[model samples]
Target: MIATRKLRRARVLIAGCGDVGLRCVPLLAHRAAAPRVIALSSQPARAAELRAAGTTPLIGNLDERRSLRRLAGLASTVLHLAPPQKNGDDDSRTRALIAALSAQRRSVARGATSAVARQRAWRGWFRATFKSSMRAGVKMHAKAIKRPSIVPDRVPGTAARPRQIRLIYASTSGVYGDCGGAWIDETRPVRPDNARAKRRVSAERQLRGATQRGLLSASIVRIPGIYAGNRLPLARLQKGTPALAPAEDVYTNHIHADDLAAILVLAIRRARPQRVVHASDDSDLRMGDYFDLVADAFGLPRAPRVSREQAETQLEPMMLSFMRESRRLQNTRLRDEMRYALRYPSIHDFLRDFLRDFRSEANAQFTITSVPVESPAE
Candidate 1:
């Protein structure tokens, strides 16, 4: 059985409380210890919902040093889920947070005149340190940041933690490039053939660097196509988005967002090593076949097909590239190491559940529409 003691009721700091982070909240909330979840988002509406869900949601910029200090002080483990920054802004934010936390520690370590005075002094120092960090963070994250080739230098005046905090950085499978129908596992060498894939490879290196330096207990989770409920591709087809079958036999993987979140939480609880974990359901369904399944689920027509030559010419460069890659991602590590089993293991299961919910919602809408109008007659 998966041990829950380490994570139960543990204070958690979640940055970028968007779709994934929000989904993780309810799962963590239901744990035995019922953790004191602290969510940080720049959006007010999102922060409000987090608050409603019994989590302490802070609405502020993550780039601010003060916010980082306050958050670091409150939680031992931090989940960084900010959008992928293409200009190294993410690195700056990480640097700032570490620096601010380091400063707070130094201030605390400085000798205090008296026990009571020291307590007061420490509190005052924390407030001032947080304020300064927040100011710096705001400037650093003001724009879209790109991933750098090498890990950036640590911020000055910040001390490294005796034992670094744990972090899980969400990544993408696009880093694998076109595997050409081969099976890929963690041990497979990365051969990124495109600009986007190259960038992801570089970003993964930076994450590994943090681990090597003993600055962070970091791991990378490479997620494939993720879908759930209304977010599934079938829903898009039902809503009349054009579904076309690619001419090439490109194989891809997918996982439910809920499952992905669960795996992450489980990994954290297990303190599973600083390593890479693929968050795919282990499905190697072809793109064309997958589309056919979606169509069947939604009772829509089979997607129109195009010749290989036509597909190459008609599709966008990015879309065409995706259809050309054919790789079966191995999930044996997740199964054996993490001992994690997917909740939705195949496209069939995903479509079945997704369609059931879709039909129920559609039926309710139809019933509301068909309700008889009460006449105001006599």
Candidate 2:
């Protein structure tokens, strides 16, 4: 029974346990008093993979509310990396997740109420017994319980309670829309211009609302372009995809995959309630120049440059959408607030190391699968 209780009291739960969520598993698993890591996966096939990564696989889909019911009281720390459904402006997935986690509130309230009621009854009995002793001409001295029936379980610096689970949300920087290559901070209000970014905005709003209502203690990490040793633009470079000309190119931010995983772990320790952070590196590179950097590092030919109007015709609408949005993100909170030291502080740092390994074929097992843009939240 003790073992069963320990297993049920898993402390960390990861939703959308894909590449990034999988990356977070070991970081939590190898701690001093390591917490049991539970990862939610829609795919049954990935259960073995999740277990191999030192996490307990919980088969649950964010889209299906019934499957998520068991999530109540299952974890105190939640890493919500699951994304919105591909089709709508609203994030139904996050809504379902919130509903499932919020289910804990009623049961916890009932428990607290029962405890308070018992304490009150015990106090009344003690006071009456003392009065009877005094009337019987016998001296008795017993101290009254202090501060009973009013215990506070609030989170530090916020009104959130222990009944509410703590969560870290992986949000996208694209929620800011087209910034005209301007330098922006977390303080900048979001003005999403497309359906994809609009969904992200809706998710953020829902999380913030949940926090306000004391359902969960949420921290939003507004991530920019994420690159790794294997997640480079090698395919796009090899495919000869046209990049925008220097005059038309826009600024983009980046963070290495390893660095991002570390940041997510740190947020659990250092992030405040309802805080927003940008998980971006320090480099400021234009879209064309970034492609050129990858091409040059990999010893590949640079693709031809095209005007924005020409790109409209040449590139797909998805690619064009990424091309339209441009902003330089400042990760001040990620540094000062989270106190995180990035492994790859800039893309150049990762590229320099990666190029050496590629030239030597140090890890011949390394493979690159094509993904179009630098994945932010999704």
Candidate 3:
């Protein structure tokens, strides 16, 4: 009975409940008639935090299909925030998830059909046999309640009206690979240069394939560099790392973490089915310019600029990999399809607001000291 009751209420399943997923929980939970929210967490320690965030924590790993069985036919909507498994070119986890949802959808269709047919037959018999008697009883109850009451409405969907599950996948903008400072849109062909970007491409392909198969209405939000006050590259800047010269540098993109979270929610609620949109802010600064801006804002010396040849030897390979990609994402589709206006429209705006509080805290720490006060009447 409890399971039946749970099934009747709308539920949203978050397959990956990390930083952004945690943010999305409250967005759904605080609605007027909120749906039940569930989050899958690999670590049992986070169960309490997930619960506190108003989500029922499902302890499961995306890699283990057996662990995910509880999620089948469970939610009307799913937010697949999990990334592709490490050490793989293809995403087997996504494949498993799609299969599970497909199986459950089919099962629900059959069950709903059977249940609806049985309900109609039972209703017909009850009306024919107990019409007069039920009328009198209903009249008496109406008098007491001051209004006539009929049987409660049936559960929302039937076989004829199967629920359509929707998915919003977060992808990486690296799929466009080294655009040579051109403006790339969703229609741009993906040219992933590394294994990491390849893996993201594979995940996007799987979701797109699922959409084509009519298993789910899916939207892909290809994100670029995500930054916020807490997630900035302050540590790298403080390390005195050198950036590529402007002539050799790549044009980079950025979206504040909060704006990315908002876009994810919007994609789930408003994005067109099978659509791909860039979730980037209006900042179109070069790699060195971005570092310089942040350094200037934080009152740190700007990183020295090095030629491409010198940077290869001086910078770490991971940093070099980022410097190789150059593209400004066109966010027309995001605005048109998702109807989203980014809260942090650019890096300068976000940093200015963040540094205001950051500088205050820094100043307070520098001036304040803890000292023991003597007890007057010990």
Per-candidate RMSD, Å = 14.9, 5.2, 11.1
lDDT of each: 0.63, 0.84, 0.76
Clashing pairs in 2: none
lDDT of 3 by residue, 7-52 (tens): 6778888888877787788788766667899998889999999999
Cα error of candidate 3 at position 80, Å: 1.2
Q: Residue 275's C-alpha lDDT in candidate 1?
A: 84
Q: lDDT by residue for model 1 over 1-378, one digit each (tens)?
A: 246664444687777676677788888777877667788777777756888866798766656666555654556566666644345323454455445434544443344323454555545655566667677774333233433343322222333333356777666677777878788897777776665556556656766776665455677777777666545444334444332455456777777778988877776766354688887886768777776786787577765677666677665566666665678888887898888878899878877776677677755532111100100000
Candidate 2 residues lying further than 4 Å off, grouped into runs, are 1-10, 110-163, 361-363
Better of 1 and 2 by TM-score: 2
Residue-pair clashes per candidate, as listed? Answer: 16, 0, 0
Q: TM-score for each prediction?
A: 0.71, 0.86, 0.80
Model 1: ten consecutive residues of lowest lDDT: 369-378
After the best TM-score superposition of candidate 3, give how far the Cα of residue 202 lies from its true spot, in angstroms.
1.4
Off by over 4 Å in 3: 1-8, 108-162, 359-378
lDDT of 2 at 113: 32
The Cα RMSD of model 2 versus the native structure comes to 5.2
